[model samples]
Target: MTDTYADLLACEDLLLFASAAISSTGQREFHSGAAEQRLSLEFLHEYVHGTHPDLYALALALHVNDHNAAAIVHRLLSNPRTGASAGERARENALIRRRLAEMPPQRVYRLFARLARERVNNRRTRATMRAWIAARPNLDLDAVKYRPGLRAAARHARVALPEEVGVFLFSPPGERRRHRYGSPLLRAHGRAHYSASDLYDLPYTVAEGFAARHRVPRGVFLEGVRERATRAERLRLAGTARRHGVGAGPDPAAAPLLRLCVYVLSLPTAERRDRRAELEGALAASALRAAGPAAGTWPRTAAVLDDSYSSIGSPVRRHHPLAAALACHHLIRALAPDSTSHWVSGHTDPLTVRPAGPTHLAERILDALDTGPARVVVVSDGHDSTPPLLADTLTLWRRYVDPDRATAMVHLNPVFDADGLGMRPLSPAVPTIGLRDPRTLPSLVELARFGEGRLGLSDLREHLRATADAYLEAP
Candidate 1:
């Protein structure tokens, strides 16, 4: 079971879903009965009771209304043995609050009132409730049983209590409160539900208004808004967010601008040149640059980045693979400033290759090996379009360049190989490591340390144990 967990962690296709089952970091863009089946309460409970409560917290966030989830929440709230720290509890509550704001107004009121009754009043929780209530002037505050306490607390804290909270919570439930306007949180959620095509036509003011009204951190919601935004609207949103100190609306790991870059790169050569500056600037501003090499004697490493058309994918390409490749290229350059030994797509220059061609892993490997570097690393999706000669090239590289059979080549796959069950290695001699997140570039350094061969089970276990211990030890 533990081995399965470890393998799932390394499996890109499963990791996010697995991670989401236990943690809030998982992608919840698609929420349906089918998606719910991917994460079971039993699995969540086990993880919640295990070393990674953060994972379960995320799962709970997604399945907050589930009976099993509610039970786990009750258990966690009552017991300290769930492995959740003070910080983790606070984070989960905050996530729940944000999710509540995205739900219907009546649902939000019910959930908030339930939490208030249960006394789950963290600072962020109270503040979020206050923000929602402040935005909705027509809500019946009497529905909230703890209205008096909340009102008193707001008054004592000199917080701006809603005018309707003064009227309805103090009056009978039969007499409903009326207002001049509707619920802003519900309105925001409504605005957020616009179809992709419909979103482009809506004025940017709608998005800005939602952002201004909602205090809860709706990053995922904001990201969706930016995704459907027009080029002009995207730029406008970015500039507005910066001015308002909200930073970028989208996740930097899979930023919309990066996808736009990939889209622009796919255009005709003459057209692509026009957007090169924008593409380069966005890449530079991303979190990838921070994964720069440490100050030390770097190894003689050659990195081959895949900028193939397959890497960018079809329909909705997040450009994550291309981004990871660029990140690796930047990492290598930062570590070994003097090393000009790297390839992207067919080009030897990493920056010159746009994601526009078919994959030729054999050619890239041969090119890198020809340089006689101590280590050859290929960053690809393992979807070689040219030929099945990658293994032959690895064999040749191992035979001539590395007669001692030292670690000659390593394949770092940014995209998970669903059919292969795990990351695919070109040959038995050459091992593969999953590069789901660019922050794991340090793992590349660990591979560099394995100067003579693949990492064994013991080696992998030791790394996992250390990681588990470190996460458990963190506050």
Candidate 2:
């Protein structure tokens, strides 16, 4: 990781700047590897106004003594993603015109942003997040609620209400996943498939999606849902069933409750954080009535890909000898274009895996629902081909839940310490709880009954104190 001063100066400055620009704005780069290989295409003179001001400064500091500018540029150019945008290219041309004037290249606002992100990484934000993920398996979606709630999920009107209402089930790895929403809403409306692809990719990170309630069901999606007679039918019926409202169905207490299962799957660490923020922002807006914090009780949400860590790319995981066909199917789909990605020029299509769609994500949600008997509502970004798979997964898991009561909600939530301060799941095979009714976020936290410790990220400071004490005892 050591570099000579002259080594840094000679690298391609334009390419470096472009990489930094993209990083600052948080945009995905469609064109990769073009900058590193193609150097001679833009036959411009060596410009001191290098692409990255910080990189230039570092190089300057290193090679300033040697006065060896060319050598430094050569080293920096070795790292890629340095192409300049049209405007930057024009600015470069102008700077070259006055090469004799030799003004230090002006700093772009973009560079500052990239540098800030760099500083944060250096400070260990990533390390903290990783530790959080690996700390422990905190919930089992199966045992979240008891029976009597399974018949009418996401509804409380049934007179035979269970002591604890089941909202959703969480299914982890190595288990059959299903969902009530498994059936494709699109199929009843038009000619859409009933099931979607499974989660083939392993270690897929998931989270409750961000977007305030009411504000959620985005305009684009709402329009689509409105077109669906079943969705409209359900909404209209729910309205009539409201307590004060007429024809609000049979329940006078069932508020205007619409449970949306929002799941952000396999997003990069940074994007995951961003999505969480978005969800928090939307929830905090109070645009929609809030529910309890749904402790780790999300519907069956697990990603099952062939175990191929240390692979070159996500696609390469398929090149192995011990992989399942369906696993490959799911992996390829996850590796393929995101729901909204556009094709590149002259590139018809990758002919690779296609998306499983919203139905698939929802099916997983529904499958998780079986782990317990509860009324649940699932919401997601609704992209990808998730809708179809959802319909099928539910019944499949139902059969698996219990052959006798085969369709009954399965006990997925294997709560290890139901009465402990920090309860976590212990089902090695599968354990996780689905999230239903997001307004229940507040209830998710089970504070220490004796007030010893709290359960959640916000309790990190307390965790740190305990860790520090343990370290002292060990020493």
Candidate 3:
């Protein structure tokens, strides 16, 4: 393949002077002293021979006979940009004046023409380079070579990368990428080839550059490919694919899944308008909070995956999704502590809900009541009262869900108050639906435990309320 650009480090730079000198007729005058003086052909030859400006001038100076002239030309050309220091330049000019006074003009012209040819070579190289630029294709995956493997696949793939790249692992079926990491087996014995189409992938292209910079040979650990990939770069690279169906749109919302004990509670009064307003309001505030100068924050959206937050946290910084997720998580935890570990993982983003501590209690309650969504009977201390709004949330869910498929998911905190009062709600008539005084919640749990068959909704609610009342009225 033809080289597309002439490395300025190597050639076209010299052509600038050659073109100028070939067209000029000397005895050109230059200022060697404070005043201008006519330069002898030989003197001029030493000053202009091989380098850009000098080469052209030397061509005009009849510099062919001067072998040493190239050396002087280099000396002046290589010196600092401000031009040579006064003392060194002055002495050099004196020596050139002596030689110019001795050489014939015809001999000078002959030497000048020869050196001009050297300058022609510079132009020729550039012309060739321009042609290459006009001909070569854009860099693509065909450029990279990977090892062969049966199950090579991109795992930590980034959608929009500033550069195209694909990271894959070679392993047996069902073995996660972690097992196949960039170990020597995958690097050597495994087989996977970098297809030209992979150049369209953002992460893969980035990895190529990273590999080149760090001197990492191909087929290395797939981790390095997407490790430092940023969200901005991913967004930019993916934009093209999105427009052309290259990749799916990223989920900017997958962030709220991080907090532990996260509970989403829609107020009992939540209507379509109210729910819309609440969600939108949360998003709006999230936007402004992230608009500040120091806004990057990624939370563990997945309950068990908080530590893995860094994997996507660094990239999420550019888009501010991390902050938004944190905002949602912060608000939701005040609602539901039972279903916190569950989250929705999607193509656009992953959602994390926190896991509450009393999973064991919740499990025991579920095992006992498999018939329907068990009614939740929370018995917690006054200090840990379940919010009134959250209490109604379970009732609201039961309205739409099948009892057999639903889970009451109770959080029973059986503890006495400072005044030695029970924590269960004393009456359903009390507008505030907080946990019954913690001491009284036990009677309700006990009633459910003694149930003959699956507790019907009305009966279960009645018994649970009576137990709360009895616990409260008891001395």
Candidate 4:
């Protein structure tokens, strides 16, 4: 089969598989393409119902190489009967959009071209093409090779191309030749966006040249180069950045500068110590208030901040779960005067606690909740290394210290659970939320209320959707 046809078939098969998986109430098998075996619809149903987030991620990755699969993903996302929550579906949609944006617009246009011929009546395919076109208005509209298919798709979709593109498309071969901007090959390469991943395979000088040509911002430049730079090279880069006013501007709102400093500290300890004052200054400036709680209309919150090795082991520095946990602690303490903080490490004082030792979570967590705080929040990776079983401990806490279970207890996990599929609840009693973006903490609390029977997934989804919509609409 031709490449376009194969891609179309793959997309169709994936959509069928997903639809079958979702529609299965208890059936064991569904014939999908050549695959003729039981794939455990029960597990898949459970997975989509909120057992794991990874399954959806896996589904995305399965046919990611095929641009047509994006249409399938869009369809899967819109299917209301699927077990995935509205928030999960929205997150998947966002992921697909980002992935689409990262691709060369030509490829997306070509996919549209192929879909136009193969699935002429597909409204989703046409809508998807229009979305990509709208996102990249800077792209040359007439750059695509397969003119007839794309023109048909655009016409059917009622998509109005720019005047120049429309003129080029309709004009005869000689006219098109005259108006052609440049070698399509060269233009395609020029339009390919380079990201931090580009640094891994390319030479440093080449990457630097690409960044300079693109006028990539200082923070992005640092992220692109940090892992590959030598200690001395990093210092030199920092000095140059300071001189050029690259990263020397006033702090932006909700800046994660503290986490960035911790990433800097992750370099050889001796090399990092020279900038100790700078790190300290960032921490101080970012804080809304000094240590200790402030008066406010806040609940008596209790938090067990996990400083275990896992939190510090995040692949992305900006997402250092430990730093995020510390930031959360500071924010809660500053906002809620009656709050108590528990640092889960080998220290009594919260400030002195460091991320060491395999998490001895069950005991420390139970002890924190036993204090009778109005609400309990556990920021962890949900790994109880030394445990009289976390679930058992939670049972004990509920039985004695919290018979009424009045406290809104939540497990905020920043790490993706590859094993459990989604963020795993520490116990059946506590709700676990995937804390991928800490800014979503406000809406995520509703999940805890859902677990407590005070709310539902619909409520959590509404709150999350509002938050996402507001962010999108923000000036």
What TM-score, computed on C-alpha atoms, does each candidate reach? 0.50, 0.16, 0.17, 0.54
lDDT of 1 at 118: 68
Any residue pairs clashing in model 4, and if so which?
Answer: 52-421, 52-422, 53-421, 53-422
Error of 4 at 41 (Å): 14
Please write out the lDDT profile of model 2 over residues 51-83, one tens digit for every residue: 343233232211121112222332232222255
* Candidate 1 residue-wise lDDT, 1-475, digit = tens: 2345444343322233332232221122111222333344344455445644444444333323333344444434433345457876666665444444444454444444455566665555556556656655444322242345455444433356455544434445334333322544323333444433233223344454445555425544455455546564554355355445654543333354334334334445554356467555555444334444462245677878788776664333345577567666655655555544455455654445566777777877777766667667787777777445877767776777677855456677655333333444566556566554454555544533332233333454455445434434445
- The deviation in Å at residue 356 for candidate 2 is 4.8
Q: List candidate 4 segments past 4 Å from native.
A: 1-121, 135-297, 314-319, 347-354, 370-372, 453-475
lDDT (C-alpha) at residue 173 in model 1: 38
Give the per-residue lDDT digits (tens) of candidate 3, residues 1-475: 1222332221222221221122112221111111111123223333334333312322212222233333333333233223545753443343343333334422322333333334433322233223322232321211133212101111111112112222332333344333443433232212222332232233454355534555554434233333334443343443343445443433333222211111121112233234444444444343333333323322211121111121121221211222223333333232222213321121122222221222122222223234332233322221212335434543444455434434433332211121221223222211111121111222323333322233333443344335333433435
Each model's C-alpha lDDT? 0.49, 0.25, 0.29, 0.52
Clashes of each: 5, 103, 48, 4
Residue 423 of model 1: what lDDT?
46
lDDT of 4 at 96: 58
Better of 1 and 4 by lDDT: 4
* TM-score, cand. 4: 0.54
Candidate 2 deviant stretches above 4 angstroms: 1-359, 369-458, 464-475
Better of 1 and 3 by TM-score: 1
lDDT of 4 by residue, 1-475 (tens): 1235444433333333333332222211111211121234323333443433333443432222333244434434333235567776566555556556665545656555655555554544456667766666543433343456457657656788776566556667556545644544323323323444444333343456667767777666766556655444454366455555554432322245334434443445554456556554555444443322332545888888787766554332322567657666755665565778887784654333346767777866767777777778888877777544888878777778678768768887655443333344577667665453343345456434544434434443354445445544435
User: Which pairs in model 1 have colliding backbones?
Assistant: 22-55, 22-56, 23-55, 23-58, 24-58
